[model samples]
Target: MERAEEGFGGGGILRQPPAVWATAGASVVAFMGIGLVDPILPSIARGLDATPSQVSLLFTSYFLITAVAMLVTGFVSSRIGGRRTLLAGLALVVVFAALAGTSDSVGQLVGFRAGWGLGNALFVSTSLAVIVGAAAGGSAAAILLYESALGLGMACGPLVGAVLGDASWRYPFFGTAALMAVGFLCIAVFLKDQPKPARKTSLLDPIRALSHGGLASAAAAAFFYNYAFFTVLAFTPFVLDMSPYRSGAVFFAWGVLLAVSSVLVAPRLQRRFGSLTVLGGSLVLLAADVVVLGYGSHTTAVVCTVLSGVFIGVNNTVFTELALGVSDAPRPVASAGYNFVRWFAAAAAPFFAPKIEEWSNVHMPFVVAGVAAALGALVVRVRRGSLVPAAVEPAPERVAPEGAEVLAG
Candidate 1:
């Protein structure tokens, strides 16, 4: 048939063609390349004879830049178009990946990694826009797939890194670079950006649009979820390290299983229960997961760690979908804004959660997850009620997203 529809396909809730899926798959590989190096940073620093305080900058820089970059990505996507932004970003990652593999000092490594974060911001923001644009039905299913890819990448990172590190720590970074290049090639050759929007989106327009009710709530939830996740994920390896385990095997396994579960079932779950159900149930599971993991026993610790991934993956995907659908604002900007807050919270988690964990136990971070998830669920309940519609509600006057024509009653 003719290629896909103009401008990908539908609205935030819309779906794209098989080509979009392939592009998304490549995007995941690019991201996994980044993620693989992150989990082992502490060990890498030690191997390079660097200090822990200095090494921490690797994560801090990435998240800080990512948060700021996400805000800009939305506006840029509107201006330059999502396809170009994502493709360019993937290419940049290839360059940074090679640079990272060649670092002579912690300073150089940190700086190169910072550049990598910029590329990530572009990939995540535009890829999200593309997936949302490409969706055939609603953004929820597409968004879930994106999140699942993220989980898959995240899962693969540490497992691959651990194996590579066992051989030579440098191998991980080098292999990651190779992966990034491959991902770049895949996107450049296959994925195509749709035509730019007919209207020019002003610099301040997205900020003004997010002033709507559901949009703000969705943004808030995304921010909190990120904080919750980063807190646990950032700390877990340290926690596992403290145990008698030989190395970071536990955290690595946890990531692998989380990614597997998210990929294997997230779309089906979204199709069956809808975003609200997934969000609510996932929040509860997260609370339970954190509590169990926090207790810090042998069997309990491992089980809890794995559950954290499972709940967090499902929570993030569902929340992303909710953010896209619940908003009365436009889809692309809405997704970008929500991710902006999410990454910001993630950026901040390391700076803050340590003190809380010091005050209580490792479980304290999970407590935060429980609270954040609860707040997110409350927002969803108040805003969307449920993903399933028992009755019809009229579309609002605002129509910023592509699906609006279908929604406008």
Candidate 2:
């Protein structure tokens, strides 16, 4: 089997076709919705006269629906095709995000967020498959491109949120709606309809895909890792106790580190040490960072929180590569399966973190998150054999097409 090189020295990353760039542009806006609310969480609570825990349900509703909706994304995309799926997802996001801005109560906002999540599930899952199919270089290059969009969007989400949200919390939602509308238009204008897969995916296909040991192991590890990831994302705003602009600045810096490491640094580390080693070590460091963030002084916590982004960036790239390559199931089915398992943690972390703080103390949630990060590393170690050897090995000088390489195995 031809292995994918971990390096991007050939300018492959930048030499994408116009369709790829257009899709990537839309992807950036879609991912921005993930962190767009971080800078405004406190403001939302105050504006709506809700508590931290109540406000945290924004993540809960969004990710819970997202997790469930993952089961149906493959089914939808396979039938309607990628372009329509992408367009449908974008339209829903545009509508629901606008509605969320108009929400009068926390409950109303949560419901709108759930609608947004459903849309996100359709777009995000399909976007990966679309990029992999249409991208010029190979699956590795496509995955890196996707991560770039994720990192950039995550980095910018807070800055935009802070600026707009400082005026009113609702402004960020409206801003997201507007941005997504632009993305919708771009995709509508620029993207051609993708050819449907030979086999249409069923709702149960993703569940069945998890029966594969490698895909299952990857998903399990990602589930635990996501707990730690979302803790920083959803919980730290309250802990930092900074003004919206300051918190936005902090997370913006964090997102820059995340983007840099993901696009530029992770491949180098993977090339040197291999993907599994890089991932496991990064998780360990992330666990330590979480511990410090939980117990250290405020200034230390702030620094560690930003530093956690480096580890997160590396893990995101490696895990995504693994998820796409590990299973015999089609990319869409495997991705759906992987996302279905992992996003539950994304939903649970934000909901439970604040409540955990309220019940015990502010520090306990981070302690739990740290433990979860450690367990993620453990899962990777324990299941290393089941994962594809190619993922951990350096690429050969001559690489085959992604489809040919997978078939050769």
Candidate 3:
């Protein structure tokens, strides 16, 4: 294994190469696209004369396609090479986001969002593998860099949405398209193509990878946690009843806390508490927070919403590390398998949250989210032994075996 030898001690997190930084920057933009429409959901619904459930299909279509596309990311990347895969993904996002902005109906927007998700699936699944292979510090630092980008992007998405969506719901779409174009340019100029895996992955590889007990358990738990996670991200804006700017502002605050905790706090916590313990505790806490948001007063709900970010942040880092490390499968295949399972929940959350509200009440959706989070914790608790090794030792770094393009040092 040719791991980057940089130790975690000192300022390792800040010591990445230019290519890693470029990939991280592009990752931030890719994640930003996830929540960019959060502040604008209500506006889109009203403008297009669609109901909440109809508008929520934006998340459903996007994540549904993303979830399905996860199955193919490894296959595509193995064949096309990482740089080409990333560029292709970014190009798709640029084209689809622009088309989404021009859409006149909610249906068209939903369809375009599905296209965006395909691009996202390709970029996100490959980015981590690329970082781990080329990063200056060790695998841990690379994971942190990736998570930092996720947190920062998640934080910024709603703010951008709120600002642009205030003027017109369509503007956020254009904004995203433009920003992704910049990301495309950045990757094109700075990132060299990564070596392909020794063996080209098949569509079945991710599924086969999940046969490992640890990987399967982690994926299952993440399935439930993602249900809770997306509930907060996709459902709360409608419940907040605030203007787009106000909703964006609230989510922005939440995202800031998420970013800080993921990049800064999670590593410290993992070092002290161990990853499984930290992950279980965070999932439990997130469940409790969702319960409070569901049952509390409006002011209390707002506070709980912001507070959930902390728990979500911790879980994201721990889970990513676990998924990449727990199985013998290659990082890209394992990630694809893990994501394929989890993102179904992400797709389900937004689509079902509103429909559940219609069937019961606003509070019930959070109640279900709370239960899902608890289940995620339970999965971790039961599968403690398999997951523990990942916590106790730093993951052994492995580069693509042979026969792929290697970046120049």
Candidate 4:
């Protein structure tokens, strides 16, 4: 599957090495656990005799920490190196997953989940740096690999959880832990550190990146985008509950389509239309999908669910890429900046969703998402932003694709 595609070897557009792709594979395996819980929340609640609220926090706490840590992980990865940081994060996943899955009490599960939060925080924060850092010289193939892993993780999460949950709710957690372990092993075997950059000794860096309008814009867009995503995700079920509509088949279709489109569908589209067009169109489609999903019932919901896969597939790669591409600050620092903004916004969103829902109804969250998405697109156009690859001019083709956009260069 190696592209063996040529790209810049120096000049900041150098090719990514094989080890980097292997590491992304490991990350995909480890990270896929994030979505597994969605399919079996009730199982967990019943198994533990916990309230629905407690079961719900499983998703909330993990994402809250993941988003918050994105800011710091970037900074930390640059200082420490991506491989080391990623390895440390993966190890923590194993420890925390075991603890949470095996816990005899609901409190123990919640506490261990918080521990999982720590590990995931490190993983989510560092992985992007590692991917972008791996692309230091620019291999678009590297970009594809990293994106594929993320997509793969997200796409398979629910289905994997569903399959494993059949055995037991705890079974899926154990399964994910085991997958993470294998990923750790692959990373151990394949990755090696490249020549290091001299660490900077300046306090002015922070003020510089945040001050960069591109960085701020990317972070803000990411925040609004995720806020909408999580808000809809957390509340969609409640909305479906309000109607006579059944959610199971719709969710399964959506989840399966999401997995398929990411792994099998988007690559061809990305190769053809290029990342920017795909990303821009995807964001537009996502908003449209949310609207249809919000207003419709049963069959329309299913159609919206399937189409939403395309939207997510296009974007799953792009936004994260933007977080890395928008700045030339020490990578970790830039990543930290983006993640801090993203997660902080995301963490606060759920707390505020009730107000949004109370102020309106289940439909309100989707309306908020649609507005954020539409406005974000407009902002990009006004600024002539380079956040998405299609929005910019061609760089050296080898580092990217033919007509692929250069980030800072």
Q: Can you give the TM-score per candidate against the true fold?
A: 0.75, 0.90, 0.89, 0.74
Name model 1 segments beyond 4 Å from true.
1-22, 48-54, 81-83, 104-107, 128-151, 189-194, 242-278, 355-409
lDDT of 4 by residue, 1-409 (tens): 1232322223332344656766777657655665666566666767898755555566567667765555555456556666777788888888888777797877777677766777877766556545665655555555555545655666566667777776687877788778778777777777676334477323345546777777787767666666656555445544554211133344445555665565455556767876556756777778887887877885676576656755654455455446556666654566556666666545555445556676777667677877776665555555445554323432323223211111100
RMSD of each: 6.9, 4.4, 4.8, 6.1
lDDT of 2 at 348: 95
Please list the C-alpha lDDT of all candidates, in the order they appear.
0.61, 0.83, 0.83, 0.60
Write the number of the candidate with greater lDDT, choosing between 1 and 2: 2
Least well predicted 10-residue stretch by lDDT in candidate 1: 400-409
User: Using TM-score as the measure, what is the rank order of every candidate, best first?
Assistant: 2, 3, 1, 4
Tens digit per residue, CA lDDT, model 2, 1-409: 1122442755576788877787788788887888889999999999999999999999999999999998998889889999999999999999999999999999999999999999977887777667767887766676666766776888898899999999999999999999889888878887888999889889899999999999899999999999999999999999997888999999899888887776667768877898889989999999999989999999998899899889888787678777767877866677678888988999999999999999999999999999999999999999989875637542432121222111000
Residue 145, candidate 1: Cα error in Å is: 7.5
Candidate 4: residue 25 Cα off by (Å): 3.5
97-139 per-residue lDDT for model 1 (tens digits): 6787788888887787778888877876567557656666555
lDDT of 1 at 89: 79
Model 3 residue 95 lDDT score: 97
Where does model 4 exceed 4 Å of error?
1-22, 45-54, 103-111, 124-142, 189-196, 200-207, 237-284, 318-332, 349-360, 381-390, 393-409
The predicted structure with the larger TM-score, 1 or 2, is: 2
